[model samples]
Target: MLYFVYTADRPGSSALREELVEAHWAYMDGFEFHARGPTLSDDGETATGSLHIVDLPSDGAARAFVTEEPNWRAGVYAAMQIFRFEDLVGRTMWEFPGPEGERFLVTGAAGEPVGDGVIVHGRLRGLDDGAVHGFAACVQAPDADAAARTVRDGRDLTVRPWCFGGRR
Candidate 1:
């Protein structure tokens, strides 16, 4: 199964995140990742969180990944949301055809299934347990509005400026 691990860093934890980068990378090397990167600020320089799409065995495996991750273990993340994901595009970020100008994480309870321009798309896991809930996506778009338009389903549509994550 594929799991999307969205990790939001604690405020003012950049220094701690930087300090654990090596350990984090080394730990992540053990998994087969679909797409991974840090969610960025509007300026595209400051990282607000980390997004990782990984293929694991079960929901327990997904939880184990987060619990053992260096950054998560070191108290870098203020919150973490894990979801069961589907690869609508069926490709990784490296294979995305869009120009790397600006990107956004547009997610909500999807009413209609997404068709195109979706770099990554999947369903969000329930907070109570591993039950599947609404859908989500990470898209490359010109702006937040455009990104939100890509997934025209569900209430409380949130559009956050994002970028390609992970080391080049």
Candidate 2:
């Protein structure tokens, strides 16, 4: 199964995060990911949180991945959101090809987007109950409005300007 893991670093934990980045990356190297990256502050420099879409065996494995992550285990994260995800795009974010300006993380009660500029997106479900809950997407667009337009099924949605979390 695929799990969507989102984590936020506690305030002023950048130094600790930097100190343990390698350990975090090394731990992540053990998994197969559909998408992974850090969510940034408005300036696109400071990391506020992270997003990971990983394929694992079960919900317990997903929880373990979050709990055992180097940064999360080291007290870097202030909050975490883990959801069972169904990949609608069927591709990793690394394969995104165009309209290169700004990006956003749009997640909430939405799914089945029929538009372009979606890097990676999917339906979000409760890991425990296995019920459909919401959706998440990494979008590339001119602005937040355009990004929001890409996922038409959302009503209550959050569109956060985001940076893809990996090598260029």
Candidate 3:
């Protein structure tokens, strides 16, 4: 099963995050990730959160992945949201064909399921039977408004600046 892991950094935790970067990458190397990145501030430099879509065996495995991450273990995250996910675009962020411009993470209650112009697209799954209940996407757009419009056919959405993840 695929899991969506969204982790928000605690205020003043950048130093801690930097300190654990190597251990974090080493831990992540053990998993199969579909899409992974750091959520950025409006200026596009500071990392405010971490986003990852990973394939794991069960909800328990997903929880373990998040809780065991170096950042989480080191108290770099103020909050973490985990959900079962379905890959609608069926591709990784590395497979994105569009030009690398500004990117945003657009997510909300599932509406009409738009996949056009998305680098990564997926739906949040229900806890009981794995039915899709919400939608999410990482998209390249000129601005947050445009990114939201791309996926917001009629649902409430939250748009956050984002970028592709990994070493510099």
Candidate 4:
């Protein structure tokens, strides 16, 4: 079974999050079923949440995975959702092709029709800012037109992919 673990950071808890970053990674590294995941964002620089898509042997395993996370244990997370997902598409962010130094900010809505083709064309795999989903990705195309062409359909939400410092 594939599980989508959405976690939101607690307000004013940046200090606690910083303190637990290493421990959080360490805990995630210990997971046996983790697959694709990413830190959620809003502006791209500051992290606001996280998304973990993992394959587990059973519901019990999924439950255990969350209970053992460092942020949950330390109270740095304010909200989260565990969804049993289906028909998941899209590759992991780590697999997205781009220069090693290339990084950009992405903000948009959750794909449409939940179970339908939500997994359309896009390399982003996380959410930023609680209001709208945001993420950082290695844009496959140099421009939006080229990126849109890669999707199953040529239509998609605008992926204002901007470099870290600011728009070029």
Candidate 5:
């Protein structure tokens, strides 16, 4: 099963996040990830949240993965969401033919998946109902405005700058 796991950090957990960064990576190293990154503050210095599309064995496993995450365990996360995700882009972020520009995570409303500068795109579905509820995508463009326009046609759309996260 695939899942979209995302989190919003507590108001002032930056230090805790920094302290657990290594542990976070160590834990994530065990997962099969389609995409992973930290959503950031507009200026790009502070991490606001995290986003990852992972392939796991079951819903229970996915939930456990989220709860056991280093950040979650350390109480750095304020809010979190896990969804049954359908990976529309079948490749990892490392293989993305990303355009030259900033990266943004655009989410809200489901529609036809676009290509171009897509790093990873997927359908966000209800965990229990299994019905697609929205769209989540990582895209590269000149700016957030361009990235938002890139994934045209959506409701409640939001664009957040996403800082690359992986063993690079």
Candidate 6:
């Protein structure tokens, strides 16, 4: 299954994150990752989070991937999201083929992460509006619980799961 993992830096953790970028990339390269990248805003220089797509056998494997990741091992993330996506567009953020990145439409209930689903839409890879209280990316996971666990480890999180077109 394809799992989309979204990682958000903890408060005041950007410096630590910058320090681990190279190592993070190098580590991801060693795995069976489709494409792991940072989430850039409209300006495209400010990295808000990270998006990673990986093929795994089960949620346990996905959990292992997160636990063994360089950045996560180095404490670079404050939260993350794993989605059981279907590749509605069947494309990657790098394959969107536009000078401008994607624009996503993430829909969900309030206080539970409304933009998590938007990351799946290629055009809106990391784009968000005011309602998008937070940011997230999408992927296809073995199941909904596994997708949710990709971000939560018995901790509080504002994650939401929705159908394909639901991703704005």
Task: Output the number of the lDDT-best candidate.
Answer: 5
Per-candidate TM-scores read: 0.88, 0.92, 0.93, 0.56, 0.95, 0.56
* Residue 74 accuracy (lDDT) in model 3: 91
Ranking by lDDT: 5, 3, 2, 1, 6, 4
Candidate No. with top TM-score = 5
lDDT of each: 0.79, 0.85, 0.85, 0.49, 0.87, 0.50
In Å, residue 90's CA in model 4 sits off its true spot by 6.6
> What tens digits encode model 1's per-residue C-alpha lDDT throughout 42-124?
77777899988899998889999999999998999999988888666678777777776677777676543354567777777
Question: What is the TM-score of candidate 4?
Answer: 0.56
Worst 10 residues of 2 by lDDT: 108-117
The positional error of residue 74 in candidate 1, measured at the CA in angstroms, is: 0.9
Models, CA RMSD each: 2.1, 1.7, 1.8, 8.8, 1.3, 12.1
lDDT (tens digit, per residue) of candidate 6 on 1-168: 666577776767678878887777766765555445565444544566676666678766777878788778888787876654334455554453434323322323221222232234322122122122333334333444544544422233333332221011
Please identify model 4 stretches exceeding 4 Å from their true place. 32-41, 98-168
Worst 10 residues of 4 by lDDT: 112-121
The clash numbers for all candidates, in the given order, read: 2, 1, 0, 3, 0, 11
* Model 3 clashes, total count: 0
Tell me which of candidates 1 and 3 scores higher on TM-score. Answer: 3
Residue pairs in collision within model 4: 41-128, 41-129, 128-134
Q: Tell me how candidate 2 scores on lDDT.
A: 0.85
Q: Model 3 over residues 1-168: C-alpha lDDT tens digits?
A: 889999999999999998998899889888888889899898887899999998899898999999989899899999988889888788888888887799899889855435456888888986568877788789888898888878646487888999888742
- Model 1 scores worst on lDDT over the 10 consecutive residues at 108-117
- Select the stronger candidate by TM-score from 3 and 6: 3
Q: Per-residue lDDT for 13 in model 3?
A: 96
* lDDT minimum window of 10 residues, candidate 3: 109-118
**Residues 85-122, model 5: lDDT tens digits:** 88887888888875556899999885554758888888
